[model samples]
Every structure is written in C-alpha cells, then in structure tokens.
Target: MIIYKEIEISIHNSIYVATKGLNYYLDKEVRVIIGNQQESDYVDVIKYIIDYIVENKPIVSKNQNIGYYSWLLQFRLEDINYYDLYEVKTDGTEFIKGCDTAISIIREQSEICSYYKLHPQFPSFNQMVVISKGVYEGKDIEAIRYESPEHMSGWWLITDDYDDDIKSLMTVHFHHVAFNRPDILKYLALPFGYRFLIDNNVIHVSKDDI
Candidate 1:
C-alpha cells in the first residue's frame, strides 16, 4: 500500500495488479492501465519523451496530411512506434516553441501553408500537430491523440506565417508553449489539453465512470 506517483494495472482478470515505477511496468507484460491521471503517462514516456526527447530530429511527412492531421514521418525513434503527440517545428534551423536542445534539424521544406486566414494571427505559415503513426527508416509510426480533437486542434494553427516562400519563418512569435514542458507535448497541444489531468486527483475509476 505504498504511495506511488502512478500505478500500472493489468486488467487481465480484474486482478488489477498494482505496480510501481513507470519504466519497470512499461517493459513488463501488462496491458498498462495507468490511473494516476497525468502522472501515469508522464512516468510511462519519461524514458522515450523526456530523458531522451531531442528536438530538430529530421522527420519527413511521407505524404501531406494523411489522416486526421498526422504525417508519416521518417522519425528515427524506436519508442515512438506507440502513442505520443509530438509537435516539432519543421525548421530545425531555428528554435521551435523556444526549445533549445535541438540536435540535428531536417528543415523540412518551407511550405507549411494552412487555413488561418481569419484569426488575429492570420496569414500564418508552417504547421505543427500531434503525429500519430510514422515510419522510421522503413516502418510506420503513430502520433497519439492524448486529448480529444476539439481540445487539441487549436495549436495546429499557431505557426509563423509572415515570411514568403523564400523566408517562410514568421517574424511574429507563434509558439503555443513558451512557459511549459519538461516534455515535447507542450509544443503540440494546448496547455489545458495535455496538462488537464496532470494535476487531477482521481482516487478511483470504474468501468461505469469511463
């Protein structure tokens, strides 16, 4: 009955076997039903997204907007074969969402044109969204939708759209998270979308509750 930041539950026989530590349970043979709200996913992806989360890794969207706003990127991360919405600035040559630990930048093209011609931040250029599945080297990777679409779609339009084709980098700062994130998700979805459950206090959850 020790207090844990997160709990890993295997729902095979309603046994609900409780386990501690994110990494320990992730590699185990369990379905992984994390119930710590925000702490669960955090602990789960720490090894893949935080400790090893590097920016500006060259990712090519095999095709444009394949399905539900995700691309088939050539991301070179093996852990990403699962779910995780990561928003990387297409231009690795510059700072994305103000992140600094960028290793190598792909600088994927310059045309990130989008349909933001109405908002105050209209005439924007470039785009970044939570990627689902993508191929690394020669495979398929999926971008996770941590929250509902309505909750996360807003960040898809906050790109630098001032520069022309020659210089698509918008001079105006269009970063969504300038003050959040120990994880790369802060750059992809709205603050409320990803951080909603981080501070939640759900003591227990039942099938009817879901």
Candidate 2:
C-alpha cells in the first residue's frame, strides 16, 4: 500500500518552490491552503473533478481570445475516449448530463472520507471544495500579457468587482495567478508561490486553518 507520509515532503517542497513568486504579489492578508486531493483514497473523484473543469472551462479559439460557449455542451457530450473512466457508459454520461453528477460524486466521496475510521489523518472534504472553488474562480480572471517578462503572462482580478453573493459563497477560496504555458502543471500545483510563503512564515493561518 502506498503511504501518504512518504510522499508528503516531496509534494510540499515542490509546491513551495514552484509558486513562491506569485505569492509576493498577493495581499498580505490572503492565506494559502494546500490539500493532497490527488493523493487521497478517492483519486477517481478528484480526477473526475479535473475532467469536468477541463471540459467546461472556456477554451481559447483561433478567432477570439475566449472561445465560443456555444460549443460547450457539444464538447462536453462528445465521447471522452481519453481514459478508462469513459469505458463505462455511465461515467461520461453522468458528467455530460449536468452538474448534478459532478456534485453528487463529490458529495458522496466527501462523506466517505469524512466518516472513514482514519478521518483525522485523511484530507478533509472541505479542502477539496475550497480548492475546486478557488480554481473555478481563478479561471474566470482575465489573462494579462507581460511585455518585460519575455513572453510571460499573468491573470489579474479585482476583488471589489466580484459578485458579492458568489464571493460570499467562496469564503474558503484562495487566489491563483500564473502564466499559461508548458509549465501549467507547475503553476496549478501551487500558484503564486503560496506554498513557499506558508512554509517560510513563522505561523500560517487561513480561514480554514485549524
């Protein structure tokens, strides 16, 4: 059996070293939270969430910086032959039908992890929710090009302009700002050097810190 403890150090170190720069640009009050959703027992559920986001998020098209949302349903419904999950007719259909399937799977997994005998040692469902919502919110931000940085780009969003209701619902959400490039995984794994700042700090605290 793969033990989480063995890999935790590497994961944590990678995250810290990757995102250290971006964290400097964020507000001092903003906090960072990192959870190993991909390492948990319910890895399938996490993969489903990633697939859902990939299928739904706006894709850059040739004509426009932002792709047409018209093709969203069609794209989502298209047969996803990329993974074994799609082997089961129910799998692809569930996500394609509506957001309900995605939500249900997440909820079920959350409950399973929550009530497991080793709950205290396992990652919490709330962490998954926080990360998911944060990623969704981050994707909505507009990408800005940086000339001096030699092809580097970044995403920026003003907190004040965000919908109050939506912002309220995202109480545990964290900010993510990184360039889209070959290093996308490095960025997504730990955007803005958030992990570094958290690690270097004497005491780290966030809305969800416990």
Candidate 3:
C-alpha cells in the first residue's frame, strides 16, 4: 500500500504546506491566511503550490519579474519614511535602540491606521528611546514632510530636549491629515509604512515567503 503525508511549517509568521507522495513525488505551497473561515482563503496558497510543482521548486531568481505583485504588496502596506528616524539620531547607542523602538511602534500604528483608516484630524505620536555613546550635540533637525493623494500629510520632527554626551534623540512624526474620504489617507499611507518597516528591519520575511 502507498501512503502520502502532508506537512506544514510556519516561518516568520507565514505558513507553508507541503506534501510527500508514496511514489517519492513532493509538493509545497506558501501562503498568508487572513481569516479563519473557508477554504477559498486558501486560493493563493493552492496556486502557489501548483506553481511550485510546475517550476520544480526552483529558488527565486533575484531578477525574477515581480511587476504588479510588487505594486500590490506596496499598495497594501502604505507610506512610511525612514529618513525621519535617521535624521534624529545623534550617536550609535541611542541610534540603535531608538531606531528599533520607532520601527516597532510605526509598524503597529501602520496596521491600526490601515485598519481604521485613522482620521487625519486625530494624529498619532510616540517617543523613540535611545542608548548611545557620543555626546548628543543638540542641533535642530529639519523636518521631511510627505503628502499623500488622500490629502493627508506626515511630518517627522525632532524634539527640543537634548541629552548631553548625546546617545539618542527623541523625535515624533505624525501621519494624519484630513483626507476627502474616510479611508483614503490610511490606504495611501500603508505602502509607505510597509517600506519603512522593511528598511528598518522591524518586520522580515523571505522573498519565497511572500
């Protein structure tokens, strides 16, 4: 008698499903499941599995064509600015911690903002913690502002308070501006936020995982 086995693995919070056949054939799929109900939620998962089989599970080429897939992912993630964090750091110790914390908070907020379509009138703010060795030479850091299509604006600004022998700087950026529609600004901001998270290493996944 011949038997088949199916296996599942979770990597970086994403899931992969694989199958091994009695005849030595193998199959696998990578996918993201949004909700708990229905097998239709597994459509992308299944398609990926089929493609994997057809392509013989080749490693993704660095130059492989992503095209619209890239855009689609960007569209879902939102707008984010990494320069804002870099501009505020005064030293290495403070820079590392502050950057990490900021990235984490921004990732959380981005998801909330994306889900709720956070209103521009109600802006969000958070402090970045820093631990550094260099003297924090207090200097005014200029703001980099971004305007989204939804008529929303984001402003990253440094604080007036400075710690001598500067290790880190505390800065705040607000992502909110009243857009014409309720969720327009939030949607526009997701890609920016996603990019920021990626650049800062706040969230990570293999190219094959996505």
Candidate 4:
C-alpha cells in the first residue's frame, strides 16, 4: 500500500517530485456514469473534470501547459443570461456535469489524446462517444454533443440537443478512456526538470525525457 507518498524521488530510476495537487487526491477515487431515459438523465462528470483541471492546472509542473483547456466554458441559455451563476450540482465531491459544455471538451480532448496516444494533464474520464450511425433504444442517438446555449446550473440534461438518453443499456455504448488501467490513475508518472516524477497521473509530459 502507498502511504502519504512523500515525494520519494529515486535517483537510481527516472523520478520527479510530485505536485501538491496530485499528492492530495492520491487516495480519492472518482467514477462516472453516462446516459439514461425515462426521466432523461445522464451523470454530469464534465463539471467534475473541469473543476479538478482548473484548480490543479496552476500548481502542476511547468511542462504540463494545460492553459488551452479552457477553464470557463461560456454558453448561452436559450436567450436567458445568468451572468455569474455558477454550477451548484455535485457528483459526491466534484461539480456535476451541468450540460454539454464539459462533455464537448471531453470528446474533443479524447480525440486528440487518442490521436497522439497520450493522457491528459488533469484527471478526467478517458472515454469515447462516437456518432452512432444506427438507431438506439427506439431513438436515433447520434451521440449528443451538448451544443446548446442553455446552461443547467443545478443539474445536467439527460438528452442534449443532439445526443440520446440511456433508456436502456443496449441502446448505446461508450468507450472507456482508461489510458492506464489496472493501476490507480494517480500512479502514472511525469517528467520534472532532469528527472521524472513517479505516479503523476493527471499532468502528462509531451516531450522526450531528458
């Protein structure tokens, strides 16, 4: 078992110092569920991803430049404006997916990560949802992209303007973004200075280890 993980940087092997953000969440675990019907519901893990990324993005190492991963996703609300109204929903501890804003980002990031075969610098669901050319659960779920202007501050809408609901399990399917599975996400490594940090899950290094 791993204790409080005291920045143990071994010189024998390539290792780097872990950041405070990665250190604190080492013991915690997060899970996400997608799609639902009847009441038209879907677990909003986007909010959770966004919040975690934003809070930790700054403390992360200099190599992990996650600035392009927009912290604040601006959107319209069917003509309604909620100036500073923030998300209040919760997924146990992190912010729940209010709508498609976060998911859209997730989809986009997943595509890029898949293309490059790399993981994100922040903790997120490593899953994929492609456009279903076939019909699912009686509805033509083309994979809701959450491209609407309305923002649900308290809860996430089940079916986005384009996506489908999980009325049944066989209705649709999702590809898990398990970049590093079988092992805890926090256990992933990253590069720091001339060395590499052991078990740096979120922050990924893009260049060669020098």
lDDT of 2 by residue, 107-137 (tens): 4434533443212111121221112233333
TM-score of 4: 0.21
Query: Whose TM-score is greatest here?
Result: 4
lDDT of 3 by residue, 83-153 (tens): 11111122212222112222333344456555546421223222121212211332232223333333233
Tell me the deviation in Å of residue 173 in model 4: 37
Off by over 4 Å in 1: 1-20, 28-210
TM-score each candidate: 0.18, 0.18, 0.20, 0.21
* Most accurate candidate by lDDT: 3
Better of 1 and 4 by lDDT: 4
For candidate 1, write residues 58-81 as lDDT tens digits: 223211211112211112222332
Give the CA lDDT, 0 to 100, for residue 205 in model 4.
26
In candidate 2, list every pair of residues with a backbone clash.
Answer: 19-193, 20-193, 22-192, 23-192
Which has the better lDDT: candidate 1, or candidate 3?
3
Off by over 4 Å in 3: 1-59, 62-107, 114-145, 148-155, 161-210
lDDT of 4 at 68: 16
